[model samples]
Target: MSVQLLIAQLLLLILGLIGVATAAPEKILDHGGKALLALCVTFLAAQVRPRTYLKLAPYAWGVTLLLLVLTLFAGKGAAESGGVKRWLEFGPVRFQPSELAKLGLVLQLASFFSRRGVQNKLISVTAMILLTTGLVLLEPDLGTSVLTFGLGVVVMFAAGVRFSNIGGFLLALTLLALPLADRYLSAHPYILARVFGHLGRDEQVAVGLDQIGMAHRDLQLGGLWGQGPDAPRWTYFAAHTDLIVASVGFATGLLGVTMLLFAYWLIVSTALQVAQLATRVRPMRPEIHGASILASGAMFMIVGQALVNLAVAAGLFPVTGVPLPMVSYGFSSMLTMGLAMGIIHSAMREVYRAQPALADGL
Candidate 1:
């Protein structure tokens, strides 16, 4: 196994066990079973051929587009009220189309930008990203839409798109968001509550802010050594998902949080190193360009989402439903992350396979 995969698995194992320990007895088996399943899926995904991805890149985008449209019409809300329709259910199995969209967008963007005449295709690429972002936003999932849009821009930038064009697009987006924020966010009580809380405006915000403050206190209560896995004070709403960093801090203290951050750093940095290596080999084969973009895009998504989740837990950002990658107790998230890691592993495999040829050329 690759070192990146090993580190990811180790992080997931540690966090999964922590989740199980903190969960109610009835839910313990559920958490454990899903974690095991995620591991199996991740392992199998890693074995896919890189060339297979190259061949399927176009079709992948089509499937994702279909899923996105299906989600708009048939997706279920995560909450009974005041939540957007973001999930598609099939009997006992439920999944998020947006998660799949994230991976699809990354792969599609990589394919789009890796080719020659990318400059001429700029308008089409921008339109594709905007359409995807618009679809995600229609789900009223602001966090994910922003993340998806950002990931596309990051891929474009990495592929050497002009900064001026990126700046113009972002400025236009910001202008458009202002009116929408006022019109829609004002009408959504729960969303308004979170936004108001961030802006220091509502009583509901106080509740969330207090939870964040309490999370900090919990960390302090744990100190350097933590209060232990079974500590009563570790409890909080969404403790196993959104606020898991705070839970870890409560259970394992500053030490555990530090270790978790270090693990994330290693994973992200390794991905970047792989991207850099792929770039050096780009001249030898066209596929290397796609691989480099894929590596960087995956790195951006994983690391960006992880940081956002951590920031929310730390009270640095207003709470959104963004879950910590690999560590959260959501099957959909686990599967998406697993797929991303698998693709990165495939890219890494290709890079290493080409190393001898690259060396001989030198």
Candidate 2:
């Protein structure tokens, strides 16, 4: 299973490099090098004791919070970022704290769920989600904000959080969002125009909408294989990052995107099977609930982000700034995903060692 995970990750990394090469040839070396470093971190994380993650969960979650707060106060923005505060700079390097928040929230949920005699679990968990999402939203990174919220939902679902609680909380959130969005969106017409433009209601956003319009044309040009016969044209904003899927599609066609989807499916399905096996391991099952949920939550962040990126590229949803998991050029994103998947690999390895039979198909 670890082997399969590695293969899938490598495939996606190669695809990311291809996307970069197609869109911004000069940056290929930079992204490819970061991808390699991330892959190393993935393998190293897989070798750690699975229980170590549980012990470190609190610290990891705390650090994530601290970094997110720091980002809001002094986060850096990329040339393509339009001054959105999504990164923290140190020396020559920049990192996205929001990336770590995804995994941190997962570990926090699993830790609370697997522990005993925790008071106000619901309130604390809800607060954690809202705070993390709120900070990212303040960065004006609606894409990452939504992605963070979705990651929380995935973790809670995997932890067997009650459906009524989930539903009621979401309902309350929607109520809170309407008025807040009304206030915020008016203050930030960039976001308001994006929403309106996406809905085809903003005639004032032609320049803004050009990105989406060009991406749509590029995707059509890709067809089944890509613009093979035509001079390959990749003229979309964020061509190597948020719009990497469209870039890859333009060069490699729908076949390329489908391959990416299939790779994600393989990884997620295998992880789910590991989680299922952890649930079924009889005497140890109760004790290892955290591990099971951890594995599930890990994939939720990795594969969930992948799906969101795909939806945005396919125009099935509004443009989300969420990059494809391992298939995008962000260094922090690659490293975060590498670490999450590696930790999940560690969990899966622990489970397989305990009940070897569970290792069969997975």
Candidate 3:
């Protein structure tokens, strides 16, 4: 098997085992089925040529935008008890459009930047990014909104947008966001509670803080080798989802956590290397530059989400409902990640095919 496929499978195996140990039998079976479907989707996507993807990029973004609109009007509420509408239910299948929006935005931005006219259309590109990001924020998924925006920023940076321009835009955004946040927080006090609840003000906030503290304690209890699956003190909620890293720590200790992180590091390192190689080739194709940007953006999304999830699980950051990339039990997230990996693989294939000499040297 290729390194990408091998590492992905191993990560899925680890997550599957965690599901079986922590979740219901039927849920574990469902996770397995979804994972298999994701693998098949990824396999098919990997076969798509770079030219085909470019042809299909606009349609994909249209569909993604349409889904976001549908979600805004008729989407289901949060899986847990909350008023947020982030998922769309089609018969028995439910998925998050915001997840699809991530890729759509990345591809659109990559295509926009790969062309020679990027320098003249910065305003238009920024408007597009803000519009899509605004729609996501309306989903009331603060985490996904922030992530999508950050990915856009990274893509622009990779495309050689100046630091002064980026900084000025961010400053203006922050200034505009402050009043909006204050107004929104005034209406929805619970949001503020999540941010400042550790201060012992509200019951819900206290419970959230307590959960973080307990997660910390659980990690301490695991020590170097872990307490195994049947440990009596494993009390963290969402142990198989947002808190999977904590679950791993409780069951397999720091060693398992380290190994899991190392796998993520390897995947990201390979992606960056592929992107660098794509950039280093002489007389590079425009499509290759676009592919490199796509690969880098995908890596940032996966690695960034993993880091955020780990920070939340470790009680070092505010709870953002971010799931660990391959380890978390969300079908939408899994499918999105699978598609990203496939795209990266396709990009790598194109790079190597364009430079047979480089391929031979590797």
Candidate 4:
């Protein structure tokens, strides 16, 4: 499809969702952020040149790294919840540098692979992971840390990391992570409670049981067609962002949830198709830099984060305050993700288009 048509569809879907959610009016401003971000993304889609992105990657990575350092030194010393410092206040707006870092890291890796086949792409990727993850972990933003790290591994995998190596790395990661979880659980009562709940421990289950119990109540309240858009998800107060799927379940019922899932599946599937097509041709093969691999990476980052956030809201995992991509109510998340989508869209625009022959030039 043409880029303009694609952008229109995205705008329609996003705006439609926001309008639907606002009918009952929980947090309209937050949903508006989605629209605002999409607008910025659309503009960026037209402005950025693909070749320029190759040069921008190094600067992007450097700036992201510098932001990470600034967060440690001057970020809001502590969030309301704990020692985590994910936000840096710019008078009125709070910025999450890690979000930018996720994109920067992707661009960096893409640029590296586009140049020469690096024998140790995995090692280079891991170094980048540690640099970003270490900074995020210090902020105690475990959710973004996991998301960013996961994105890095995925990009490396796309660059053709051996499966055997991936297996070993994952195993090592699992071992290292377990002890951290254990230490965290030991250090914080809330962490212990959450871990215990996740582990199905009876004692700590009640800490968050009210939300679960209420969600079930909301589920039962919704019949086949649902309570309708006018129905308010008051019981699920965090519904608009963190527990949005539950809100959909409550307000629009199971069918709405099914449709939402189907829609995203379509988006991701379309991305995969573009990637696959890009992998086949030659003149525009490098264009695949923004297509299959980077597109896949972006989808993974967005969808993966949504699933994790949803799982936490469902009490399947400990709450980590991660927002649902495109659906969530955060300026940084919406805009950054929109920007990343624009980058991918630019890649797709050139994906199957015929490139000018080199000899024909002159």
lDDT of 1 by residue, 123-178 (tens): 77878788888888888788888888988899888766789988887787788778
Candidate 3 lDDT over residue span 1-362, tens digit each = 13764575467557546644653344677777777777777778778766567667778877898999889899888466466888899888999999899888877877777765346647767786887798988878878888889988987887667888889878988998898987766665556677676555677677766777776776777789888766676455676778767666777778877778887787687677777788678897788887777777777777888888888776666778887876777788888987877777777777777786776655
- TM-score per candidate: 0.91, 0.92, 0.91, 0.84
Q: Could you tell me the TM-score of candidate 2?
A: 0.92
Least accurate 10 contiguous residues by lDDT in model 1: 19-28
Winner on lDDT (3 vs 4): 3
lDDT of model 1, residue 293 = 76
Estimate, for each residue in 1-362, the C-alpha lDDT of model 4 and write its tens digit: 33543543364345336433733365675566566766677567635655567667889898999998898888774444565567788888887898888888888877776665446646666677778877877766767888888888887777666878878888887887787876755554555565666666756466554565565566566666578657655644455656555666666666666665665565576566556666655754454554556666766776677678768766677766687666665677777777766766665555545342321431
lDDT of 1 at 120: 64
Q: Each model's RMSD to truth, in Å? A: 2.6, 2.4, 2.3, 4.4
Candidate with better TM-score, 1 vs 4: 1
18-134, model 2: which lDDT tens digit per residue? Answer: 888888888899998999999899989998866778778889999999999999889988776666788899999888999999888888877777774223457878898998899
Clashes of 1: 0
lDDT of each: 0.76, 0.81, 0.75, 0.66
Give me the candidate number with maximum lDDT. Answer: 2
What is the C-alpha RMSD, rounded to one decimal, of candidate 2? 2.4
Q: Which pairs in model 1 have colliding backbones?
A: none
Distance from true location, Cα of 245 in model 4, Å: 1.7
What residue runs in model 3 are displaced by over 4 Å at the alpha carbon?
1-5, 23-26, 78-82, 198-204, 230-235, 359-362
